[model samples]
Target: MTLLSEFQQTQLPASYANLDPATLTQHIQAAKAQLGSKLLLLAHHYQKDEIVAQADFVGDSLQLAQLAAKNHQADYIVFCGVHFMAETADMLTAADQQVILPDLNAGCSMADMANMYQVTAAWQAIQARYPDEVMPVTYVNSSAAVKAFVGEHGGVIVTSGNAEKVLQWAFTQKQRLFFLPDQHLGRNTAYQLGVPLEQMVLWDPTQGQFKGQADQATRIILWEGWCAVHQQFNVAQIKALRVQDPAIKIIVHPECAYEVVQAADVVGSTHKIMTTVQQSPQATHWAVGTDHNLVQRMQATLPQKIDFINPIACACMTMNRIKLPHLAWCLDQLVAGQVPNQIKVDPETTEKSLSALQRMLMLS
Candidate 1:
């Protein structure tokens, strides 16, 4: 396992360029069958249908990471998700197990928005101003370095599904909480827990400060970052859907804006969204605001008339990087005893990151 910083090149070979879809699928399936129990293919829900079809397990980022950690038989954990997710799997899984991302370039935009330097500076400024214990809570959609920082500072990692539970626990330990990466999720979860909007503030990493007067009264400081996919859905889309058919129920991910979430009939994690749509047999019409791939998947497989709130909403470009050709090429390399795009976190980073993750696990 090579660290990301030491990773040099992992571009897909030109041999796969002309391969037809059927050929690619055959190659992927063959490699899987050959690898057998030695391989565990994990795909995030945001992945395209073809990728999901080849996955041994299809779930959200955290769910996939947890699955990777539990599968001890698999020597290779091929994660068909973004870079951050792969990094997480590597951190959680046994040191002997290698985690691979099909495409080296598949990275989360939200994770890139906040880095170690910016987070360190923000913590310093907040401590200097507030004179209170400020707890750090990072979303799973963040870099391992950020998670390490949180862990070193005695904080816990959180996901959309367990954010409320973790945040409540954080508040019990500290006077203030600094949420990393995704502002919408932090704000939405805190609001649901009865934290007033006035008590929550926004932190601007670019400016090296908070957006407003984030004083001692500020209980929650949200980092200025969001998911490019979920941010596309707005209140107007909900209104249009309502006007088109009042019977249409709007289910959305918590990553959407607060206004959009408020207008939504149901708000949850990606797993929750899938379960809600599948279990609600009485609801026929539905509008989902999240990644386009997952919504499109539901539309095709589910009995309900499901639609993406914003049809024009761009698919997760990073997740789309893991195409059928890329998967085929990756698996073929593995068959040849060559590892490509393997994600490996350094020892210090992995240890610290696991501290935060384990804290979350304990709470859960």
Candidate 2:
């Protein structure tokens, strides 16, 4: 329940460092057996194979949060993802349920880009210029505070899987849509909806001004933020893949740059990318552009039928912070009736953020 600043000193015991991988795994399994259904461990797709192997449920942030929210039997929810994700689970779950993050330092850089102060200032400035004309839409990767801001302003939250649908719905409600903490996603989604490139303007939070043409009747105002991992995959990588194998299909997450997404043979969320690979023709080759861990998982899962390669070597370092040692330590603490790194959003923030989350769940 403490603020992130107050809980800055999240340190594990020195004894955890001395435990071997086998011992750590054994301890984790033992703790799980002891807690049984009362403990729920959630891992994001970007998490390492070891962490995912230990998770009771594995999916994207929204999927994990929805699972945590609906689980009435779980007393403890340990999220093996970034800080924002754990904060989201806290917002969605019942008041009696507790959510924990394995590492306090695991935070999304994109989410950190658009803090509440910058967002509040931008909202006020935009509204001052065009009152009641803008509808805010934040990606699920953002902090709970940003989601609360969107909800309080009559906006909705969206995930990569349902961004296009949610944006389409937003366009019907307001004259302009303001997407936060991920410019690439906003631009890619807006462009897919037939919004002209010239009509979209980038709002640079650091500069505190619009980057593109300000007078072209902007329909989508994209905040100047992006995923560090996805941005590494560029059009050049796709070009190289095409040169290597004309038959190879390139699939990328929508978080990639507009040019990269446009060049990709298929553009979708992580789930869609995985599904595409699963349903593809046997012995097909694929070049994937997303978190390296997820692609590695797919490669391992479909080893016999498909050959998967990372178009670029990139991984979300924040997600990778939740290693075996951290997981084992967290589970040990939970089993011993101690909750370390518990993530709890303020009551007011949770109330407002849930409104946006609920709206997205209904629409998606």
Candidate 3:
């Protein structure tokens, strides 16, 4: 199945919400009682309804990292997100704190786009073209290896929250910047900042060269990677939705295609989408483009207000791997003094990767 329609079940989802509110409350109270200072549940906005509802802290990548890092009192951080996100949490937190994922198979396709070998070769090729005048900047939706490549080379990482500013800061530091993992975001942000489309070019991974009509290299260089989920919200889909429901406020993630972002009323991260609706005064309708779990959860909460914009539902298959069962089982193992799904990064990789994260932090 394609990334948009894919839903492969590696494990079954168990009933984590079967108990009465009072009983569920009691269990959490008891868990806290038994495992004092040993637990901190951090969930992503893209996580399922059952998992997100019970999380101690919930946010996007940067927010989750900040939460995991500052919460030094907790010994175990059960991250309800993708593998890279858990890796990020682990890198940010103290050495004593353990970051565990519910499912080891849950990975981000965007993160898989660029690895150490690929990135090194790509950077080297780009360097051959532009020499040390260019900087390597990657989106946060990438693997630690990619970040390490950037960090070790005096490059920086940019998140959706601060991509534009980071790009501005990057250019000020270096003559040129090569953005990776999401071409759409890099292009859109660049265009927004008066970086002419003529100046920006696409870096073709297969050929290892600039392959766009625009010949100028001073603008942003976008990698070929994209979020399949966000890409599903194409111009045709947006047009169809608008014709069907003109009142529906279109909201999208910045990772989406430029046309989709331009069509939407608001473009932001997943947390911003939730907060937008939460802060809306009237009963506003929304056509959201993101992970299915998050949009589904929003619809469940405000049934009359929010719905999936896509006629063919867009689902991030990797994000769906960590269902309630995997979550419960992972927590159960931790509760039983066994680390079932611990993800630890090597010190060398960690040292390099942390610098990229630090660059993003310093940019913000």
Best by TM-score: 1
Of the candidates numbered 1 and 2, which has the greater TM-score value?
1
Q: What lDDT score belongs to each candidate, Candidate 1 first?
A: 0.89, 0.86, 0.77
Error of 2 at 115 (Å): 1.0
The sequence of per-residue lDDT tens digits that candidate 2 reaches over residues 198-270 is 8998888997887867663889889999999887877776787789888888888999899999898899998
**lDDT: which candidate is best?**
1
How do all models score by TM-score?
Answer: 0.97, 0.96, 0.88
Clashes of each: 0, 0, 0
lDDT of 3 by residue, 101-200 (tens): 8777788888787766667777787777777778888887877677777888888888887888888888788877789979998988887777877788
- Residue 115 alpha-carbon offset, candidate 3, angstroms: 2.2
Looking at model 3, report the run of 10 residues with the lowest lDDT sum.
1-10
Which window of 10 residues has the lowest lDDT sum in candidate 2? 303-312
> What TM-score should be assigned to candidate 2?
0.96
